[model samples]
Target: MQTTNNTVLITGGSTGIGLAIAEVLIKAGNEVIICGRRESKLLEAKQKFPQLHTRVCDVAQKSAREELYQWATSEFPHINMLFNNAGIQKEIDFLTGASGLYDEESEIETNLVATIHLSALFIPHFLQQQKECAVANVTSGLAFIPLKIVPVYCATKAGLHSFSISLRSQLAKTNVRVFEIAPPIVKTELHREAQARKQSQRGIAAPAVAEATIRALKNNHYETIIGEANVLKGASRIAPKFFHNLLNKVATG
Candidate 1:
């Protein structure tokens, strides 16, 4: 898919990987519109990058998701790209049953439901475009290898991984290109700000994922695994037992 001269809408674009992707694509000469739950953050992103079009939408709700799609399409009829990048992660201790039911539900709604719903919402509009169009779903390395502590988060990503595959197959004959970006843990505000900052030091930089994604789109690589995510994919396929045991040990320790 051509990266430039396209109008793109990214959910969770106010910060982290979504913001980084917006920066990269904007620099590459595409018009970028970003939506998030926080109006403050959206305003902040707009302050930093004046060219960005901003919207406040909580994708966890069906109404907000539909409203966003409608507003985006009506306001920017040329929009040809949708990046379902909004997500949240939580550590749930199922053995002790420490996480609330609401938390788990939110993870499912935001990560899996929003991704699928937004893709379905955009495909028809994307196909209507005479030019090439694309939808990129941001999943995680944990989609391939489960981490016990974040079971729901991992499960949602795993579901998203499957959804992307089917969506791509369905759109193969159309003008839309389905892309999945599975990135190794990146320093993002998906967690508490302090924890996210510390994790950022240990994880792959968000910009690295953004750059890799742009490269993947340019090269038409449908499934883009960035950084150490490839290790998770390879290890899961070759040594599933060892990978699970190792991940459990590290997570528990």
Candidate 2:
């Protein structure tokens, strides 16, 4: 993907890795549009980066997704990139008899459903464009190795990883390059909240993930993994038991 002369839209761009990626790409000279559920966060992001274009959209809701799709097409017809980066992670103790009635839907909705819907919504518009376009899905290292505590979150990321694979193959003849970014646990508010909920283990910084992602984009690396995430993905193949047990310790501790 060219570093400049393109308009990019990122979901959950108000904070954490999304914001970091937005900052990185925008600084590289692309017109960036970031959407979040909170108006205040969008306002805050606008204040922090005055060049940022903000939109208020709760992707968990179908109507909001439709509105966002329509608005993006009408407002930024030249958008060549869609970053399915917005996601929610929650720690649920399945052992405590957390039943099916529990509301763990946010993780599935925001992380998986939104990605599918957004991809479907934007692909046609991208295909209509004359320029080379791309879709970057922000998956997790956990997609390869599931953490039992956050079963739903891990499951969603895994599903997303699978979706991106099929989407890429299906669009192989198109100009849009499907990219998957598998991040290691990053030091961000997402981890802070997981820690507060007694869910996830400690992780690396968001800037590191963002920097690695930008480099991968520049080099056209389709499936990109950073730091320990690469180790985890490999360990899940060769040392599944060891990796699973190690992560279980962090959740149970």
TM-score of each: 0.95, 0.93
Which ranges in model 1 have alpha carbons more than 4 Å from their true place? 96-98, 103-105, 191-200
lDDT of each: 0.89, 0.88
Error of 2 at 128 (Å): 0.9
Global lDDT of model 2: 0.88
Per-residue lDDT over 1-253 for candidate 1, one digit per residue giving the tens place of the 0 to 100 score: 7989999999999999999999999999999999999999999999999999999999999999999999999999999999999999877767766556485348889999999899889889988899999999999888999887678999999999999999899989999999999998787777553264354356777899999999999999999887778889988899988998897786555
Q: For residues 153-210, write the lDDT of model 2, one tens digit per residue.
A: 8999999989999999999999899999999877776676566755545577788888
Which pairs clash inside model 1?
A: none
Model 1, TM vs. native: 0.95
User: Highest lDDT: which candidate?
Assistant: 1
